[model samples]
Target chain A: MGDVVLASLLLPLAGAVAAAVAPARRTVAVVTAAGQTVLAVVLAVTVLRDGPVATAPGGWEPPLGIALRVDGVAAAVGLLAAVVVTAVLAHACASPASTGPATEPAAGRSAYWPLTLLTLAGLQAVLVAADLFTTYVALELLTLGAVALVALGGRGAYGPALRYLCLAVLGSFAFLVAVALVYARTGTLTLDLAAAALPPGPALTTALGLATVGLLVKSALFPLHAWLPDAHAAAPTAVSPLLSALVVKGSFVVLLRVWTALGGDAALASVLAVLATGAVAWGGVLALRAAALKRVVAYSTVAQVGYLVLLLPLVTPALAGGDGVAVDVARTAWQGVLLVLLAHGLAKAAMFLAAGTLVGVAGSGRVADLGGTAARAPVVVTAYALAGVCLAGLPPSLGFVGKWALLDAALTGGRWWVVAVLLGGGLLTAAATARVLAATLREPGPGDGPPPGTPHGREEAPGATALPTPRAGERWPALALALLAVVTCVGSAWLADLVLVGAPPGVGG
Target chain B: MSTAEVYLVLGGVVTLLGAVRLLTTRDRLAQVIALNVTGTGTVLVLVALAATGGGEPDPVLHALALTGIVITVSVTGLALVLVRRLDREDDGG
Candidate 1:
């Protein structure tokens, strides 16, 4: 498992470099997809069985050489992420990718291949990183790779790309500052050691605050999420899933590691939970009102993130206290959070990919103009609806099971407010789903007639690169990803059991 | 103040000014320049924090700071590229 983790971390990078220099693009895609998926799958299987796997390059201990650690949580995510990357790459290869934004369509196919794999490599590194500096380096690498992907969408891409870059840099800088501060004060760069030595001091508090703020910005939580929609909305079809699903998850995984490593901070957890609740409500409302379908899905990404962060408060009582019941509840809530994370990643990736298909068919992103997609692309509509089922926490879906576990935890822990927020969030998400479905289902509005050739053209918002017609090769990947979302629903029981084993060591131990 | 303290103070001031400039300015090039200044200050702060009463810098900390420097350079390079593209687009070239 240790060796597998190492391979998973290194292979994408090696593949990226090879892809860049290689004359043949298809070979790179095939080899990378096979190698990355195999390694991640093998590692995930081992992790579920063996608990956790770790490796230190050259056998040097932490505070010295870097160590790569992958726990069950990372392995689960890596497994899903590996599949998503493979599917997207396959889609990219079938359609010429690096039509390098609108400006440099001549930039050649190699342009997209390298960055795509590089993003995966960066994500893998962040997942396995055991030390703060290692995570910092990997995070920056991931940020760069993601921004490149966005910019690759061409001409109009620069505006959103620049905003994304600035915000991303700012967030990563905050994270870096927190990292340096932690190392300086504690003289340790490893999570467990630093958290252990961290005294009750202003410096520790400041570092925690800075790290959270940075991650929140990176995660695109509500108000700090201004850069997300346009940047995500504007990216090329294949790029959206990677951005919405995994790039954002990179920082979020970091946040989880930092908070849990510190055991917990109730005050910060409470404040963040409040913000999470706000995101759930605010993002849902915005999604319902969004003019473009892609932007709606983007806002939903922000909304789904709300569910992810609620784990902080849901489990904080146990992590921050000595109460046995709280610990019991924390265990359940932790499992629920991991499930939600997995479900959202799959659902969002599927939704984005499917929505990209519809946008292509309609030739415009306008929700109202998206009419007739149900009749045109039922497979795509099915995919979107299935993913939406997860988002809305409908019964028998992974989202429902996750929300159920969370609700149970909140109820048992007597965190009634969390319960209210959870129920309210589910309803709001349902509303957003209803809005998209109704718009897509109903006849075109009175003001606008049926669109003609390339229904997506003419209405193109300034700076929005026209959504290309659906590529025949990309449909399978889109449908496969969405089906996987459905499979996760059926397999929720199995997944919950597997994930619960990975919950952090008993709080207050 | 001691030499180290003076360096720390200077670094702090530069970093603060750079952050303010980065936030307040709308010009892409100006933001990139501001980020570079902030980046340098960040390196300075890392170096300053590495010092102990032992009167010597930890080589390991210096290595980490050096890594920071390299990463910052790449980020700045990317930003400059984007800025250049923005300029070209604005010029309608």
Candidate 2:
């Protein structure tokens, strides 16, 4: 079991190297993705049967050698990553959009396969890392891969990629500073050991504050989220799904680990919840107004990130209450969080892939251009709408199950404000999603072409028969992911059980 | 105050200055330089922190500092390449 856990991480990294050298980069990438998916399922099943699995390489343990553990949370997240990454790779394989003019540079095209594999490897490392410094290193690898992937979008991507790099690098330094302080005080780098040894002092508080700030920036939470939309929107179509789905969540998992390790603080949780609310409102409004199709999906990611942070306030021991009540609430909230993360990753990736397909058919990225797309690309359009419904937490989708659990937890905690935000955010998300669906599903009016002499619309001929048909490869991957997002809700109870095994301290057995 | 304290203060001040300059600067090159300055200060702090142990400098912390240096170098190289790309794009126009 332990060997399988280790292979799940190493295989992708090894594949990255092989892809870098091999002439058949895509084949290398595909084979790696398929293998990793199998490893992830094996890891998940082993953990489910036997509880958490852990290993300290070379028989060395914490304080000297790093520990890698697969708890319930890590297993669930790893499974989500494997499935989503495979679907995304399948989508990329099917679509020519991955090698479009936006990725025209030779470096961009060839580098994508290796970078994708590297990112998967990095995420796996981040998931299992038991020490602060190791997590930091893993995060840096993840950031490097993500930044380079953004640059693969060619000219329009350079600015966003650079901005992302600067902020990400700065955030990493701040995280490193926190790690140093942590090591200084505890004389240990392993999370559990350091948490146990850490004295509550000015240094501990400072370290926690610095780590929170750094992670907030990396996770792109609210006001610190300035770098997300452009970077995500401008990324090559093949890369955007991975960036939006998984990379941002990597730091968030680290944040959850750090916050839990040091003990949750009510004040910090409340503050985070408030910022999350801001992200929901701010991101939804912007997404509603976003002109481009991909930008809408990008901004929606900002809003969804808000929902994920709601877990903090709900799970905080001080805020949730005492004894089994607290444990119960925390467990419910954690399950909700896992469901939200998984559902968002699958649904969001599907949305991006479908949006990419629509853009391909329309030959432009404008939401306006996507009007009447239902006729030309019904499968992709249906896929986009289904994913949007999942994002909005409609019935039968995994997102709905997740949000229901969150709402249930909030009600139990008697946090009326949180309950309001939960419901209100869903409505806002539905509205924003409706904007795009409306555009795509609407029939083209008789005056589809520019009236008289509109200069910008001159190039677009009305009812142009030149629109490309989305291939089965392009169409099927998005639909498959969308279907998975909805079908997974059927397994919500089983997923909740999986999340309970080796659950965190506040969440009971 | 001991030598370690002095180095800690120096590192903090340099990090602060670099961060402020990085935020305020409009020039991309200057921002990249500021990031490097910030990185250097952070590494100095990490090394200084090791010395505060009141014995031989800690190997683990030194290793962390070395790791930080490598990350900074690679990131800086990537950043400079991005700046050059943007510059070329502008020139092509």
Candidate 3:
């Protein structure tokens, strides 16, 4: 089992190297992506069938050696990431070879695939990291790879990517400083060891505060979200899914692990909850007001992440309230958070891919310019609509299921204000989605003939068909992921069982 | 305060100063330099902690320092490229 866990991290990294060295573009991209996906799926299954898997790189243990451990949450997220990466790579494979006067430089294309694979490796490393130092390394890997991917959007994207790079580096620095302080006081860097070694003191408090602020910046929770819209909106469409859906969640997962390993605290948790509530409201309002399709989805990410942060406060029974009641509320909150993460990962990726295809066809991402898009690309439109429903937390979808669970937890915890925020955020998301849908459904007015000066004539060229069409082949991947998001809700009972497998009996709920 | 404590305090102040400079600087290159300085300060602080041997040099801190170095280098490289790209875009017709 340890060997399997180690192999899970190593194989993708090896595949990434092979992909880089492979001369053929098509072979390297396809093989690397497929190999990583298969490895991820197999490992996820192994983690699910067995329990959390842990291993030291060599034979050392604890404070001396690094350990990687994966629980049910990590496995689920790993599986979701694998699915998203596979879908995006498949879409890239099918799309036209992007050789044009305006295509991104060859150097940029060369850098993209390798960095993407590296990013996947980093994410996997993060999911399983059992020590603070290893987790920090994994996060740095993720940030570097992500910054590179963001810059691949070419001229229009460089500014945003640079901004993101700066903010991410600063966050990493802050986190590193905190890790140093913790090490200085506790004499150990492993989270479990630190928890054992250090008593509650000023050093610990400072460490936690610094680390929390760094994560808040990296997660782009609210006020620190200055870089997200531009970075997400301008990145290559294929890149957006991974960035918005997977990378940010990686940091949040680490934060959870840190809190858990530290035996969990109430005051810090409440601070996080209050911030989360603010994020939900702020992100939703901003998302509703965005004019670009990608920007809207990016803002929606802010809202969804707030929901995940809410789990931090609600996870501890003491934070929620008294014995049985608090326990039940916390359990519900955990399940809600997990479900939301799963659903949002699938739905958001699908939505981005669908938007990518639509933008490819229309040659624009302006929401207003998308008028009559549903007429020309009904399948893509349908995919987008389904994704939107999931985003809005409409009934019968996974979003709805997750939100319902969240509300139940909120209500049970006597946190009526959080419940109100969740509902309002959902309604705002619905309205924003409707705005896009309405635009797309509108009839083509006299001025709606493929926005002035668009290269409509060029689109009719022989090789132009290679550009994504809403036709059957291009539609299935997005539709399938979107459907998976909806279907996962039905598997809630099984997921709940899995989440509680190793948990102390009756302690969880 | 002990010598080690004084050194740690100085390192922390330097790190914070570098961070503030990085955030407030208008020139991209200057910001990158400030970021590098901040990273160096962090490393110095970690090394100081290791030297004290109060608990034994934490391997986790070593790993974090190594990772931070790699990330800082990569980001600096990328930032240079972005700055060049911005300049080119501006110069282009």
Q: Which candidate's DockQ is highest? A: 2
TM-score winner between candidates 1 and 2: 2
Q: Evaluate candidate 2 and give its CAPRI docking class based on DockQ.
A: medium
DockQ sort, best first: 2, 3, 1
Tens digit of per-residue lDDT, candidate 2, span A200-282: 77887788888988988999999899999999988877888899889988999998888777776777787998999999898
Residue A437 of model 2: what lDDT? 83
| Cα lDDT of model 3 by residue, A69-110, tens digit | 877777777777778877777765555322111356877776
DockQ score for model 3, please? 0.69
Which candidate order results from sorting by lDDT in descending order?
2, 1, 3
DockQ for all candidate structures vs. native = 0.60, 0.75, 0.69
Write model 1 residue lDDT over A16-115, tens digit each, in one string. Answer: 8988888886688568878888888787777777777888978987778889988777787787788888888776766553123334656623578888
Cα distance off (Å), candidate 3, residue A67 = 1.3
> Where does candidate 2 stray beyond 4 Å?
A100-103, A318-321, A445-465
User: Is 2 or 3 the stronger prediction by DockQ?
Assistant: 2
The superposed Cα distance between candidate 3 and the true structure at residue A115, in angstroms, equals 1.8
- Which lDDT tens digits does candidate 2 get at residues B1-93? 999989999998898889889878879899899999999999999999999889798888989999999999999999999999988888984
- For candidate 3, list the clashing residue pairs, or say none: none
Q: Note the clash tally of each candidate.
A: 6, 0, 0
